[model samples]
Target: MARIQLNNIQKRWGAIWGVRDVNLDIADEEFVVFLGPSGCGKTTTMRMIAGLEEPSEGEIVMDSEVMNEIDARDRDVAMVFQGYALYPNMTIYENIRFPLRMRGVPKEQHDTLIKRAAGLVELTDYLDRKPSALSGGQRQRAALARAIVRQPHVFLMDEPLSNLDAKLRQHMRVQIKHIQRELKITTVYVTHDQIEAMTLADRIVIMDKGAIQQIGTPDEIYNDPANTFVANFIGAPPMNLIAGVMEQGTFTAPGVRVDGLPAKHDGKVTLGVRPEDCTVTADGGHLSGSVYGVEPTGDMTYLTIKVGDKLIEVKAHRDYRADLNSDASVGFDPKRIYIFDTASGQRLR
Candidate 1:
């Protein structure tokens, strides 16, 4: 049972800081994801936890023991990277058995452990094939089987599925989820993909500029964002934000007037509304504009409307279609609107 805790974590190089003031607690068997764009310090935090990189300031505790001075080999953590990292000369069976051999497990048990691990990942038939003979997906499964063979207390996976194509990625995502649930080990996964984070994590820790932006369940993160950054980051076509003025709970801008907001302040603000929350209207809605672009994404169509100088996307029915530059209108419930301070980017609760 590994319950990991990080306190006041910080990492720096000379004067440039890579991570800053990160504090998180991972319950035993909890699957947490560190999600962000590139250069956001997600990978750095994971490395520090793995004992690959030491934090300049902080304490890492695993199962009530301090790990700052401990060697990575003693951490009882398994890591699966984006690359296969398999030995070309070794068969998949030998590759999966490498960890057990290095850990000094009895030679009599190697066959049983290797077979169980390979079977879990559906790589049982490919055990005799070398890494070079396997496809990319098969190679990744070999890496996963290697990690699983260790039966470690924690698993650290960094972008493990990013190397696969879309279809393979989707398949691997399902397999990973099933494996994690079956093993029930404390797992920390790092990825820049929101879909992966949303689908896999029990909770998500979103980071930006070397700092944590927010930590919550996927439902909370998607429906209730903390600020403008989170509002724009989590969705496929993120929330639409229009710069305007908010006075007496009414937001007004050129070609947009969304009234009955919840804010009491009066100043420059940004109005945010999700595309799915909007509906196409024959009557001139609170917001109307010309169709700037139309894109059909199989199940639904996305309409880009030019509201004055700002472009906002609205989710329409799959059958909806209109000529470019045609007049269109969109309406949303007042309760669904999100208000943020334009200058500070903070939500106006």
Candidate 2:
């Protein structure tokens, strides 16, 4: 296992910068995930670490050794792509054994290592089947087995589960987490899927437009986002942001009001509240609006309220009322509120 550090790393495509001044310190045996939307420089950052693409500037240090000039083959890092990247004609056992063979392991040892990896990935039964004969999930498991058989110091995965169906993705998530924990190899997985990052990562690095936005544990990023972008990006249904001014210890909006906001913020501010934070009240609430829509998710119901030009989503245990066009007052606790600077989108406190 190894620790990875990227110092002032940069990647440029002619005049356009792909990834700029990116610095991250990943500890040994830590499972760190790089998460962001597409074209957000996540893949560029990973490629630089793998030496698949050299940085325009900066250094990559692994296990305390600077690897700026190291070739990918010499870096002792293995990468699993979105596609399984297995040889179609090669049987699963052969595919798993290929890396060991290339590394010049003895033929006798290949069986033991390959069998162990296949067993770990639950592919012992399908070891003789070719990639074309396997299901998508099975093929992915084979790919994972191949990566692990080599026992590289650092494992870099670029959306390795993107090709699977929803159900398979969910199952593979648990499997991947189990394997990562069992092996204790340093891993950096890049994905745009927030659920994947939240479930699998020890810590998450959120990026956008080639810049680092925030890096923290899943709870830290979800509960206390560093800025407006992180706040909006990390949550499902996102956070509701209301533009208003803080005056007289309250936040005044077009057709809504949040009480006791001035204690934490002043001047122009954006008030943030998650769907789960807002409540429907019959009376004595902070704001009132008509229900725009209702979404049911079996365990919880999400209600979107239309207040002038703004729409706020509230999460409730169940569908509160039978009618859809009802008006309701919604209230938010002051402690659950988030205040941000309108101009800079930075957190207030």
Q: After the best TM-score superposition of candidate 2, give how far the Cα of residue 209 lies from its true spot, in angstroms.
A: 0.4
For candidate 2, list the clashing residue pairs, or say none.
none
Off by over 4 Å in 2: 262-264
* TM-score result, candidate 2: 0.97
lDDT of 2 by residue, 1-349 (tens): 8989999999998999999899999999999999999999999999999999999999999988999999998888888889889998899999998888888888989999999999998999999998999999999999999999978999999999999999999999999999999999999999999999999999999999999999999999999988898989888889999888987668888867877655747789988988888888886677787888888888889888888888888887685652566777888977888988899999988
TM-score of each: 0.97, 0.97
Candidate 1 scores a C-alpha RMSD against the true structure in Å of: 1.1
RMSD (Cα, Å) for all candidates, in order, is: 1.1, 1.3
lDDT (tens digit, per residue) of candidate 1 on 283-332 = 56879899999999899999999988899989999999999999998998
Q: Ten consecutive residues with minimal summed lDDT in candidate 1?
A: 257-266
